[model samples]
Target: MWRVFLCIGLLLAIWLRWRCKNRRLLEMARKIPGPPTIPLFGNALKFMCQPEEFIKVIKDLMIEYGGVFKLWIGPDLNVVVSNPDDIKLLLTNNKTSIKGPQYKYMADVLGGGILSGSGTLWRKHRKIATPNYGRRAIESYTDVFNQEVDLLLDVFNSLPKGRETDIYKYIVQSTSYTVCQTLMGLSKEETMELPHLQYLIDLSPKLYDIVFDRMTKWYLQIDPIFWLTESYTQQKIFKEKLSELSAAVIKHRYKALANSGDKLHLMNSEEDSSKNTQLSVIDRFILSDELDSKELIDETFTVFTSSQEASAKIASFFLMMMAFHPVCQEKLYSEIINVTGKDDKPVTDDDLKRMPYLEMAFKEVLRLFPIGGMLQRTINEDISISSYTIPAGSALVIPIYHIQRDPNLWNDPESFDPERFSLENTKKRPTYCYIPFSLGNMDCLGRYFGAKLVKTIVVRVLRKFKLNSLHNFKNLRTIIAISTTSLDGFHVILDSREKY
Candidate 1:
């Protein structure tokens, strides 16, 4: 029996090797350019450990290879396009042929929701739902945005003046509350604080890094879940618990809508009776009956999963830039003060447009430290560019982070110069190069709202307090997962500007 088992294992190994080698040859025949891959592991070893530098390395590699390059993450073939013309070819001219696929893991976590859903489903959902993030919808939500901003300020106010605190957590909590109230019509405390949601955010990237690093393509194919060994059971539990919370929220929304008569906004009710008498974004989808319960839950979960991390990272970037560049911060504060006086009613939509310096500061921060840093698409059909052919089903990524910093486009790209976005300079720069919110149809839907939220919070905080980095705040490195994060946390000293 032992001899027979050994023979079977050996046969499987030989077959796997043959399969890997054959696919490798076929991929290389396409003549795509990239850094050389090491043996069975390919470029996985070089990439897995230092994810924060992933885009940096990819940008360098693509530049060396001239515009487009092929990289092997085990058996997975990814193509990187850095040149503006090549990117436009993929993201604009052939967007349909190059659909979002690397987002599959995220889509599975979301179950064909707006961000993940493709083709007809994406069109239907995007067409109807995407409008909620429009100018009018964003205007309607200013009251909510202001309310949340005040609450965030309250949280910060409660902290001791000189004590160290995790600004990341504060930003996460603030943005989580804002998204919850805006999208799902729930308060932060009312929403499920399931640990798994956090676990999934923290663990998924680490697992990907591990699997792609340790094993060859043959090993990964044998067991995709192999990376989830005994040491990671805590993460499994967190995911399971979060899944339960998603189901519970869905069930609650369903019952409320069924029992209600008018189907008005559910959150408007100050009384228990009113709480049971309206519809939310959740209710609308549930009543549509087009999505399964699991898909609905995943969709809502996706909002929570994606929004908080990205928003928090963005908020952190906004704060870090302000903290480091006091001149920029002062200019913004003056602009905010001009519109909304101290202790005045929260900022309004009309007020947002008038604050040019604030807008400039935010734009500069986004240009420097974009939330996602890259957008990816996979080819669906063969395409030709500059006499070179790109085969079907090839993975492609747009390094927004690199492009924003490309010295050719902007003068002194590394310098935090808000004036660079001044009317004159912006017109001079390439339109596509500064796309931190992405471009084309698949751009970030909540960008307008998210920007407003960040601006409101920054104005409130900076107006009341002057932020300075702590003495030990040197070497603050970013931990890159789904988003770039300062994992050690943003430690800053706050001095109150004036008494309320």
Candidate 2:
């Protein structure tokens, strides 16, 4: 009886090995390059063990295996692309796909907003939304940006000269106000609610890891039993808080619009509409008949969460980098003073054109500490790159950070030199080498608005004060979410030039 059982088990094992080998043979026949993958687990362990270093590992793998390489996470195979030419090919190809499980996890947080929505829904939202970011609309939002910057400058001026404080908190406050005002037309009380909202936003990532890490973790498997039953309470609370804030803004805006007769506070009238077509997030929600209240809330939440987070990180990075590099900061500050004449005046688009050094500084910071470090797309159809034939449904990750720091791509890539972005030098580099805003149709929808807002704030802050970091603090640790965030807050000292 024992001998017969052993024989049956051996046959089953042989069949499994045959199936495994056959699958590998098929994958190889496609001629894709990749590292040796272990069964039931792939590159997932790499992400789990070293979250911060994973981007570097993926980049090195791409360098070794070629621009197009395949990596597996359990049964799933991801194709990574580092070469600009291939990235351009993938993104420009109409047949290329983007929807994948990784994005779905983002959707779990972002919901079915323009940021997370795909297909016709995403297209329509993009179409309607593009007009809102027109020149006139962005111009209208300049007041909000300037207002936030003024508040930030005032706060910095009030700080004790020698005392160290975290610049990140101030950056967050300034960014949060700008985003909330421009989007919701939020009142003081409503705007004050943002710190709490930010807290919720900050917590969501930790909760996301606990919830979604199941798929990546070997012991956890795909079962939601642990996360659902025990680990996800905080996530639920944060989601509820986000929903509440969005719902309140929607209700308030709806009431405000209904009350006003001639002056549409949030909505654009015919006359004003021609001048400033920029609609807030709430305005978009109100205009969207196809979207339900729940959907509106979800979309607004995504906007609030994404915009505030990215803007804050960018602001913090700029301040910290400038503080550490005084000469560059002074050069940029001189450019700003030249343009604005040091009267705390609002920056016009024409003025922005003259501040090329400031632009370079912004670009440099973005290159080093990009908010969205990776851009991803899935192959919708079979595509050949070099010697490899890639199959459909495979994910392609473009690590922006790696591309930014590639030694082959840039001379002294690690250094914080802003001159690399001068028009002459910039023209020498590949277009894809400097894409913090990404490229193609699916790139960040609010890139222009974000750029303008960040530039305005940087100019305002630098013109008003000299920034310095806390003593002995050489490094700023960052957390990766939809954006890279300072883990400890960007600590710095401020010296107000205006006061003297």
In terms of lDDT, the best-performing candidate is 2
What TM-score fits each model? 0.83, 0.87
Q: Write the per-residue lDDT of candidate 2 for residues 78-99, one digit (tens) a residue.
A: 7777777776777767656455
Clashing pairs in 1: 196-238
Candidate 2: stretches off by over 4 Å: 1-30, 193-198, 201-231, 260-278, 470-479, 498-500
lDDT of each: 0.65, 0.71
RMSD of each: 5.4, 4.2
How many clashing residue pairs, candidate 1? 1
Worst 10 residues of 2 by lDDT: 265-274
Q: What TM-score would candidate 2 get against the native?
A: 0.87
Alpha-carbon runs more than 4 Å astray in model 1:
1-30, 53-56, 94-101, 187-189, 192-227, 230-235, 264-279, 471-476
